[model samples]
Target: MSRTDPQFKLRVPAALRLQIEQAAQATRRSMNAEMVVRLEASFAKEQPLQEKAHDQ
Candidate 1:
């Protein structure tokens, strides 16, 4: 992460943590990058639905 970006403290189960580590290695990304990418994609997917709900 960039120095200007904020940092957060998070805890994960062992199984999930292992999965994330493996995925990050496979994708050649840091664990933080992997998590941020997944979270951003998840929120982006949900944003459209949220907008639709607001319109209704």
Candidate 2:
């Protein structure tokens, strides 16, 4: 299957931008992929435990 990539335009503080770049390098992932993964994980954490439990 062909996948279409999603793009986001974010305005981050300079310090946070540097941190993201560093994290991307440390994990050997491109900046875009690193940001997407981080955002997904962050949203996943905010999900209700009950909702997640029901999914399983």
Candidate 3:
């Protein structure tokens, strides 16, 4: 994220935070990037289901 990118404060359970930390370390990314990647992937997963629903 850049200085121009909007920032939002978020709170997650400690367990979840730890999971993110581990994933970030393994992927060699910051916590912020890890969360962004996972969030984006979630949206990608939903896209196909959304299209199926729209078709029906």
Sort by TM-score, best first.
1, 3, 2
Of 1 and 3, the candidate ranking higher by lDDT: 3
Best by lDDT: 3
Tell me the whole-model lDDT of each prediction, alpha carbons only. Answer: 0.95, 0.84, 0.96
Model 3: per-residue Cα lDDT over 13-54, one tens digit each: 999999999999999999999999999999999999999999
TM-score of 1: 0.91
Residue 56 of model 2 has an lDDT of 97
TM-score of each prediction: 0.91, 0.69, 0.85
Q: What's the best-to-worst order under lDDT? A: 3, 1, 2
Q: Is candidate 1 or candidate 2 better by lDDT?
A: 1
**Taking the tens digit of each residue's C-alpha lDDT, what string does model 1 give over 1-56?**
69789987889999999999999999999999999999999999999999999999
Question: Mind giving the per-residue lDDT tens digits that candidate 2 earns over 5-56?
Answer: 6655889999998999999999998878788889889878878885878899
Which segments of model 2 are wrong by more than 4 Å?
A: 1-3, 49-56
Clashes of each: 0, 0, 0
Rate residue 2 of model 3 by lDDT. Answer: 84
Report residue 51 deviation for candidate 2 (angstroms).
4.0
